[model samples]
Target: MLSGSPTQGMFSNSRIGNSESPNSGASSSFTQPIIDMSENDETELLSITWNQDYHCFAAGTNHGFRIYNCKPCRETFRRDLKVGGFKIVEMLFHCNILALVGAVANSHYPPNKVLIWDDYQSRSICEFTFRSEVRGVKLRHDRIAVVLEHKIYVYSFTDLKLLHQIETLANPRGLCCLSHHSNTFVLVCPGLNKGQVRVEHFGLNVTKLISAHDSQIACFTLTLDGLLLATASITGTLIRIFNTMDGTQLQEVRRGADRAEINSIAFSPNVQWLAASSDKGTVHVFSLRVRVSGEDSLTQPNVAQGPALFHQNSSTSLDPLISTNTGANPNSTFSFMRDMGSWDGKSAHGSETFLLRLLPKYFSSEWSFAQFRLPQSTRLIVAFGSENDVIIVGMNGSFYRCSFDIVHGGDMMQKEYVRFIT
Candidate 1:
């Protein structure tokens, strides 16, 4: 989700200072807009999300859960948790509906439970309790997907009635993503296999699993409409995209040749661009329309980034896994990846795609475009504030706004960033 406007507001008792300072190295074509609202404090942000309407963004802190209007950037509404910490939060697009879970069980809301909040009333309308701890939550218009360590429970958003239950491997983080498109309600998650990705078409009662990687599946994301799905492995060097409706391999890109931890994947609203951030302190952007021969977008064998920071170059193909050109393919997790030999295959249009080998921007020594580079730690959650701007929040309670301007083909592009929170 993106931040909508500058004058949008947030209301909190905490005194906030607002001023715009010019950023250095901004493109001459457009001035970089930077908003530094406040400095860092004792509060630790456990979770943050923006409503679909993009009117406000919510953050969970030791102080409590609070919402701030976008344009004005002041804390708006807040509900402090008496005992527990809110770890995962999902908001229905622009709706007053919110789904919340605690990182640790508290007397008010247990760890193994999910609380549904109606911000209009400033209280939890209802809650769903489970036997195991709830790892993640995603809300669509009419459905709610709750992730468990080893299973997933889909429920009717209206009544919270049991809809479907899916069993996965031991999923500790409870990762899952829902399509942002209004017409599509698709869900994707880690499958039973170590490197498999499962896609569920909620309206059609159908599911497809793709052999995404040979290593453990680290993270994956779905485009706003759910037509495209991107998956990365624990090795974190490569990323593959698959069609959600049919299990056909659409495209693949490399994040780096060597192993790095992938943090998140995002698609532009137009679906023309994809961006990924890893612990290597870099964010790689790729064009979906282009294909690379003998390489994925970020994968260039033995090649290092412009800054001389990255090392390693290995690529994989999407063969060996059955494709469903005519009908749904088999989704079996019985075969281990190592036993399946080489999955390397060439793309049909690999030779036609242009190459983009720009050095990645460093957030730290490994700078991520979305995170604050602190001396000790950096954890960033990225969201689009507009078509060309990215809003990032650090775990240490910092917010950053990055804006890009009119593109000059090739590597000539202007960009600027503002510190919204510290």
Candidate 2:
């Protein structure tokens, strides 16, 4: 029910900006109405994750998988169990059980399959089947990998059997696992322009094959001490940062001022902080350091500056507080240049900002609501839904939950709370 693109002008009700070029920094600003369903309900949703019990969070739609419960119900203001379903389209929870996958059978069936639900005991026990069409689904503890369509399988989450497959000759489209390394995993496929990343060591062999992004490689992350490795690329909006040992590339941050196509890359489980998402919905968070001088890289930690994904020439502009005219379009400004009079694109990009409100050209803060206009081209991913919440995911699967507080700390912050159509 998610994945979109029947065209029809890309299904719009109000993503407005029908091209509004004046610099496309787009900003008519308004958001915050459509919260939990309504305006005809349609619901297609698609991906959401966060359920090791932090109050609840699980979503994936096309016909199954829904569980929202973040405290709500002041006498029926809604959301008490409003959904909870679980039709299934990929899910994972381990130890307490809840592993799903079914959802990809249309022209009379046949599409890899694997469903194993049991959130406490809601049903479903097993199905497993694979030959194609799964595309990715991690999960670590008991270990599970599932990536069908050129193989990847793995599994063992306590008896779910099948332990090794990994065959990707090509086409994988993003898969992750390595918060601290259960065995090291990472795979990507910006539609397969071919941007290697192999790590595998389960039985020991392909112990690393990162050709690292020149193209493809759309999203990646791993710095819970698994030793840095942050990739991004759907062509460019730059975001390298490798060295997961030898893949070396360490340091590069460029953000959507022009070639925006970075959709997702996160890493803030305590490794400092580094969130990124773009396809114009923006969402940057930087603050990760380790650059000991000209050529140690993995930089971006002088602190105080916030937006501005690119543009810093004259020796990074003399750094008296970093700010070399982020204007000319670092996708519509916000690099915190020494406090340009209390810069506010809403905490930096919409928590609120209005100098007469005219901020388009790729402006960021719609806060949440990864996208509703189905039919592809939204991307926007973002992760970390538990320790302080982040989850955004939206190609068509729709998802939204934001909560950040940081405030001048190592990662610097302000999102505070953004329930954009949860």
Candidate 3:
């Protein structure tokens, strides 16, 4: 996540002027310790994100969005006044148009509005008026999607322009996009009876509707490669993975009484693992397989009278759809591996619990989500945070940054870690 050494080691020798000028003073850079504001209530954070271009951290809170630049002692907090009568409730960003969905957090305000902001400038670039309060917001590629009431609206980036409008045919709750490669998307409407996810492609007429879970689809995530799709329910009980290509069911992953509701799901950059947030205030990380095996192949089940050598119970229980008989080429779909234990959700007291849990354990070298604590009792609604960059949302519309020490556990190491899922 976040990795930085003392600045003096990296930037000690520097000259400010031309070689001819012998009097040019030598310039030096020194690394300063990050100011830990958890000790003070004023610096308490609500939500934080990484501004990649700026190489610094930015956060959104009950007060306003604040930027934390690396420069020493410089002012970073900026109060947004352009979007009048709106206090930021959610901030979502993609490659373009840093979109912010805000309602009247202050009861004294009239009507609610969603503001689309430019990532770097901190200005309201586009505004959209909604009938009901916005429950969720997501931005992908050049399109911005929002959920209100039972409808999901997709719009062009900025200008608050409308693109395609779709009704969930049920209560629309959460929205997830398939990845940057395809314009396809899946919608989660928990209010509907059984957990159902609608897959729709933007341009051509191709849509797949299927029942995903026995209960509500609390959280879902698509691998960056767009190969695998994973979903978890509110019960924190069941998690399923699907193949993105043919809309086939892959694996059931896990099912049982888990202590938390699945709130957020994140895939490792390399697609080697997945991180999921639970309502019990913890995170779960699981290893992802790149290819299916002998019993997990899809060809055997559907073929007519292939060899009856393998028992039906072996391949059926893990994934009934995949077969080993037909000699069909194994599909590289991103689905869950049926048998695996969830990572432990234990927490350390006082200090940063996330820092400790996100590190590699003895048996499994991969990182996991561990429960971290806040100043007081706060019902964490949504966590758009990462190890180096995390923002936890509370029920009272309050938010705070949960900072953790960065450990070098992966290939891609960043100076500061702030993962934003839009």
Best by TM-score: 1
> Tens-digit lDDT track for model 1 on 78-100?
55544455676676665566777
| Backbone clashes, candidate 2 | 19
Show where candidate 3 strays beyond 4 Å.
1-58, 67-96, 107-111, 119-122, 158-161, 169-174, 182-193, 290-422
Candidate 1 Cα outliers beyond 4 Å, as residue runs: 1-41, 50-56, 69-74, 290-377, 405-422
lDDT tens string, model 2, 1-422?
11121222221332323221111111223221112443334555555554332244456554444554444301112211133322233433223344455345322112344444333323334445554566656665555566655556665544455656555545555355443333333332222237777655342233567777766566676654344567866675667666544455644555645677665677656544467777676566554442222211224442112112123432532232223333322222343332454434434344234531676534431112122122234766565655555655554544455655543322223233233233
Query: Distance (Å) between predicted and true CA of 48, model 3?
Result: 6.1
Query: Over the stretch 279-396, how does candidate 3's per-residue lDDT look in tens digits?
Result: 4654444444433333322234422222221234454333433434321211111111111223354323322334337643321122232234443443443332443444444433
**What local distance difference test score does each model get?**
0.56, 0.45, 0.43
Full ranking by lDDT: 1, 2, 3
Ten-residue region with minimum lDDT total, candidate 3: 329-338
TM-score of each: 0.67, 0.27, 0.54
Clashes per candidate (backbone, < 3 Å): 25, 19, 12
Error of 2 at 177 (Å): 8.3
Decide which is better by lDDT, 2 or 3: 2
